[model samples]
Target: MAVGLWLVGRRAATTNQPQLATWRLTLALPCLALPCLALPCLALPCLALPCLGSWLLALGSWFLMSDLDA
Candidate 1:
């Protein structure tokens, strides 16, 4: 879903639709972040602290990037 949105946004940009591009790209951010937020829960018992930290970092970065878009 994230990849699809990103591609759609790129296509919109090349076609001169700035608003569509921005909206799709903005939507993609959370889609990208969803896996990061989910992975820790799925792998918690096996991966523990390291997995949590990395996913948290990813989630944080996603939030930061999303904020920049706003």
Candidate 2:
């Protein structure tokens, strides 16, 4: 969902539509927070691996791509 919104924002930016890009990027903020909010769920054995793996992946991607907009 965050990726989708980011893509939409990028497309909007490429098309010279700043307003649409801003809105799409703004909406993606909450989606990005999902992994952080779910961190506490890692305490459950059943969710440990999956949750940790996804959280790590999201964190890695965030760090790697964070400079794209700069």
Over the stretch 37-69, how does candidate 1's per-residue lDDT look in tens digits?
444434333344456577689989999999999
Off by over 4 Å in 1: 36-70
- Give the C-alpha lDDT of model 1: 0.64
**Model 1 lowest lDDT segment of ten:** 37-46
Q: Per-prediction count of colliding residue pairs?
A: 0, 0
Point to the candidate with the largest lDDT. Answer: 1
Mind sharing the TM-score for model 1?
0.40
What is model 2's C-alpha RMSD?
15.3
Structure candidate 1, residue pairs in collision: none
* lDDT per residue as tens, model 2, 13-41: 89999898886555444435555643344
